[model samples]
Target: MKPRSVRTSVTLAGGVAAVAVALAGCGDTKAGDTTSGSSKVTASPEAPGETGGSGNPTGKATPDTVPGHGKTGQTGGTAARCTAGELRAGWQRQPWSKDGHVFATLILTNRSGRPCTLAAGWATFGKGSSGRYQELRTTRAAMPGAGTTITLKPGTSAFEGVKYDATQGCPTIGGFGVKVHAGWNDVPGGSGPVVLCPDSFTAGTIQPTMNGVNFHS
Candidate 1:
């Protein structure tokens, strides 16, 4: 892996080049809310005043449901079988720092007797009035195509991680929830899986530490 920098680029670890993963294996997001159709979900604002998880020690609020955990697409339910065997795909979000930095990893395992391709990207959102999104950030990978492609042996899994700087506006960190969408095409299987993880942006320290809540009128 390359050193973490602001420059937008995808550097493959095992000398792999320009292979975009076909992320269609996982389900897509719903039109309006990311949590639509999800089981009893909730959305909370940036720490402090909200009636949810108490604010981090610094007094910042902890966001409710993570951003990407919301619903995606109208067709709800477990994926249908389009292929012979079962293919597993999922991603996890790990908090790097409370100061708006995060890392994400994608995992794909092929149960069939062959290899597969995968693609993935992140969708960011913020809470607004009437339980809607107020802000969104869409990032295009610095690579040549949509995502990286990897071949997996039967019963074997592959892992990939991407580091990002989540400023106040970019909703990856300190914002809402995040989810991973992964899949393989030209192979037998159903739609991929979506794993949602909640994130806390306002959990960071105040300007000089102990920065109180920002109450607006």
Candidate 2:
């Protein structure tokens, strides 16, 4: 499991609220769009597009490559071929649904240094009803690389979301979220995924309800 970055995890619950506030801001509605501490925040709908960070997308490995620290190695079946870049970080979600399925959204960010790319792939694991742990699902997107140029400036990021729908013959999203130990095939080796929660999970905070507790399968 990635340690979690504040930028990504903290914003999970705000998704629906963001849209609500943005809608209420049309006329004389009070200033509800700004999230508590984020006084300058404005709400807007998220769009589907290629997401990532900036930097030397084609450079040496970064210092933050610790296990469960977000940047996974390319050995465990999943690979995101990041050439050489400055910084590569991602935001992910683990919120459960009404029907018992957990949804995940990975928002990749680049801090601009070199050009790089992330492959689309995923895996899931957790305990099963039989009291034994099992691999729920593993997937590889056909697209080779989601490339980004090194020219992007610092603080820029990208977003991508995929649902592990319950398919009889495929991996289900019911188990406790899997440890993101795999990387894109392009960067094969095996490392941990960078987590998206920042600060510690707290009551009423987005992290707690979104990722703090794990559901037993």
Minimum summed lDDT over a 10-residue window in model 2 is located at 17-26
- Point out where model 2 deviates above 4 Å: 1-85, 92-96, 119-136, 140-153, 165-217
What's the distance in Å from true for residue 186, model 1? Answer: 21
Model 1: per-residue Cα lDDT over 1-217, one tens digit each: 2111000111112121111122222223222222223333222222222112211212233432111111111212233321313344333333222353433333334556544333222222222211122332222221111222233445654443332343454322122221122222121111111111233211111111111222111
lDDT of 1 at 196: 16
Q: Which of the numbered candidates is closest to the native, going by highest TM-score?
A: 1
Judge candidate 1 at residue 149 and give its lDDT: 29
lDDT of 2 by residue, 1-217 (tens): 2221111111122111000000010121122122223233222222233322211111111222111223222211222323223333333333222232323333333345543333322212222221222332222221122211212223433332332333223322211222222321111122222121221111111110112112211
In order of appearance, the predictions have TM-scores of 0.29, 0.26
